[model samples]
Structures are given as structure tokens and as C-alpha cells.
Target: MAGTYSVNTNLIAKLAELRITEKDIHACKLPAYEQSGNLVQAEDDMFGRTQLMTPATLTSWQNLKKAAQDEGITLLLVSAFRSIDYQCELIAAKLERGQKLSDILSVNAIPGFSEHHTGRALDINTPDCEPLSEAFEETPAFTWLEANASRYEFGLSFPRDNEFGISYEPWHWACRLLD
Candidate 1:
């Protein structure tokens, strides 16, 4: 993926504040994502938080959700479009709770490196599953996504033993831009 945003001094400083070094960033296989400047309000998530995404992503998400609904599956949005600052805050909070940075980094991408910064990634859940849990893979929604999400240009970001070294997140999907 091409990054439209550069790692400026501010982002570098933020990463440093969170104890992330240039070596650490380079070591991660995930690419840095630029925050989308043309995001539109997609919808309210399960927790009533306003979610935003690129217009193309929003259209694909709606179409994907409708297709799933037509097949008696329900996909609920848990998260979308997290900012670099928000990612930093999440990591800082975990650190404050005494979690090891290495442990936290496995799950949460370091600041600007998160796919969420691109406004194309989503965390989805179904009514029957716990939000953000690996148990989501057991749901019919997951099976349906595995079978059909590609038709709508969405794909699971991290499956078992993904190249990025991130944990397997069954609920995290990203809408890929067509070339």
C-alpha cells in the first residue's frame, strides 16, 4: 500500500513518547497509512459512536452489509477510522495499566502505522458475538464474509499467521481500492 502521509516530526515525537523507536517502526511489516481527507460519515456503530470512512469504503460497506442481511446474516460495525492520536492514546492507556509495550504492539499498530488511519479498515461484529473477540470467527457472519466479502472489495486484514505478525483478528476487514 502506498502511504500518502509522511512520518513528520510530530508523528515521530508521538511514537517516541510511546517508547516506539525508528527501528521498531521499521521492524513492523504493516505499512504506514495516511488518514483520508475525504471521509464521509458512514453510520453510527453498535455503541452509537459516529463512524467515518472514505466514500468508496462507505458504499462498499453498505453494499456488503445489505448482501449479508439478504442472506440472513447481520454484520455490525464496532469500529472505523481511528486517528493516529487515538492510536497513541490507546497505547498510552495500556501502558498506564502496566501492559508490556511489546505485548500491546502485537495488537495495536503503532500510531501512524495503523490501517485504521486510512479510513478503509473496519472492526465488525454480529449480534451473537462479543465485539472484537476472536470468537467472531465462529459466527455465521464470519463464514459469510469469508465467502463473499471479496465481492464487495473487502478482505480480512489479519488472518492466522499473517505476514504482518499481528494477532489473528477475525473481525478486522479492510476495503481495498481498485487499481
Candidate 2:
């Protein structure tokens, strides 16, 4: 489980030669929306539109799903790990669509600043429930997570209106350990 900042010596030297200072290294954690590594037991085992979660994230998500199922709630994955290049492409695409870089970075993380870089985050949804919007934080799943995520070693990286600068992602969850 290599982390986002785990760069090789060769790459380090190359970056140094380019005068890319540490302050310039905008290493974003992988977003909960992008899938990566082996988050799921089966590669294709998606709850809905989301896919490509690491194994650890998938295990925790499954546990949460089972608990929800037992309580008559249906949970689904909406998105999960995007590659660095993919994210760059996304940013480029957004800019092409006329979105300002500053505005985009405010809501969408700048490539490396995303938590998905760590392969520990996930985005979830509920079936027959309204698709997750900014207000999804008020839903039962989000409410359930507020109380129960800690039991599964999962946590909400961004809480409601916290001073973290990053926007709140109610559907996002991350593992406490790689596992």
C-alpha cells in the first residue's frame, strides 16, 4: 500500500532539478470518488455507479452495507480512486467547460490534494433514495455514518462547515487504517 507521497529517489531528484519545491508539490489525497488498488473483493462488484475501491475500503463499505441491509436500508457506491493523470484530465476538461480553476479547486480538489490518492476513501448512496446532492448530508445514510462510522474504523474526513477549507462531502468516508 504505497501512499501518495511515496515517491522514488529518481523522481525526487528529477523534481528537484526542475526546481519543484516542496510548496509546489500539491499532493492531493485520492478522492472518495475514484476507485483504486483492490478495494472490492470482486472488481465488478459495484453497488451502483461507483467502482474501483481498494480492498480495505470495500471491506468497510460492505460491513456498512450489511448493517444497513439488516435495518432495511439499501446502500450503494456512487464513486471512488481516480488516477493522477485522470484527475488532471478532469481539471482540464472542467476548464474547457468554462469553470474557473479557483472555483473548481474550491469544490473539486486539485489532483494530489484529493484523499482518493490514499486509496482509503469512498462515496456511497442509497437505492430508491434520492441521488446524492450537496444536501445528501441530511440523509439517513449520512446520519447513520455520523454515529456508526467510528465503530467500523471509518470516519468522515470533511464534516459540515468545518474549517478544513475543503468543501463538505457528505457521502464520503475513509478508513482509519490501510488494513
Which pairs of residues have clashing backbones in candidate 1? none
Tens-digit per-residue lDDT, 63-169, candidate 2 = 87788778776666666665655666776777788887666666666554567655677676665555546667767777777878788878887877754456667
Instruction: Give Cα-based local distance difference scores for all models.
Output: 0.90, 0.62
> Each candidate's TM vs. the true structure?
0.91, 0.72
Report the C-alpha displacement of residue 106, candidate 2, in angstroms: 1.8
Alpha-carbon RMSD, candidate 1: 2.3
For model 1, what is the alpha-carbon lDDT of residue 58?
Answer: 92
| Model 1 local distance difference test score | 0.90
RMSD (Å) per prediction: 2.3, 5.4
